[model samples]
Target: MPPCQSSQSFALDAIDSLVRCGVLITEENPEAAPVCDFWKKKGSLKWTTTDDPYHSDSDCEEQDLCSYKISQPSRCPDMLFFLCSMLAGHLRTLCWATMALDLMNTPLAEAEFVRQIHSHLWNTANQKKQYYESCSEEAAHTAVRTLIDLGVLLEERQTGGVFLGVSPLFQLSENRQKLHYFITQYLYS
Candidate 1:
């Protein structure tokens, strides 16, 4: 399988594991164990982690199989730090991230945004139904809005068209790190 397919596979396996086991453990600090051990063991995905002991506070559990509750202690507080991929199963955000990375540090135009994303998804996954075929203009807009709300993307309105790129709200170094981490965690798993 391709790299992108492998990542999505890992993500699917993670969802399956959580649904089956009802729990996933982690360390108190997110940086200590960025990826949960349950995912590693279940998906056989080589996710990086520190040799830190798991703490009670990091024990995120599913309150009920019927629905997910944010109030549950098993939902780690550090999860709030995760990007769109972690919180949502949608692939649009990952597509946007892929487009930005393809720009090689340049800005992307909003006019042809969906096409760019579609091309990236197609090239990476080599699948029609799951990648390019599933992408839509509405999904792209929703993904952009999600990133904008999270302060990860900036939208610029010009005379002819709009542009999208890393938000100026963060320092250059911080922006680079955040983008790198987001892509690495989701697309490269």
Candidate 2:
């Protein structure tokens, strides 16, 4: 939920987003059963019976319903969407996420985020100071505005330029949890 510290550190990769979101488990776990009849419906996720070797210690031996590690194998693009949804769902618990993605297929909305990335491509050192100086608040405003429109980032003030926080579920990824803590416990606390 913490504002991307700087553009360089921000990742727009959706696959990375999935990995960050932890493709291990999600609310839709129950929907992936093989004989459950519900998921067997057309357009439902194609899931086959599986025996997960990676169920955590928290798993129940008796009706261990989470055999998802098999249905949605790792390194697949289709799994990214599901994982992203789950991560997005978890993030919603804390706050709406306003990510500045550097997407491979799509474009980033914020000019400042993009420009900052360009600066990184040109010069990696002192990137933060340079980005702040060269980047425009207007771009951040535009990006934030677009995100609010897309439901990715929510605006704290409709007339101003202060961004709140991203979803806390993003913390399931690498530094996301610490970033959330930094925002809630330190920065905004």
Best model per lDDT? 1
lDDT scores of the candidates, listed in order: 0.46, 0.35
Q: lDDT by residue for model 1 over 1-189, one digit each (tens)?
A: 456565445554554455444344422443332211223324333332223344222335422212221221355644433543353435444544434443534356765654565455445445434444334455555665655544556678877678866654332654445555554454422
How many clashing pairs in candidate 1? 2
Candidate 1: worst-modelled 10 consecutive residues by lDDT = 63-72
Clashing pairs in 2: 1-166, 12-102, 91-169, 97-167, 171-176, 171-177
| Candidate 2 lDDT tens digits, 23-113 | 5342245544432222234332222222444533234344433332323445574764555454442332222122233221122333443
Q: Per-residue error at 131 for model 1, in Å?
A: 6.5
Task: Please give the lDDT score for candidate 2.
Answer: 0.35
TM-scores, one per candidate: 0.39, 0.21
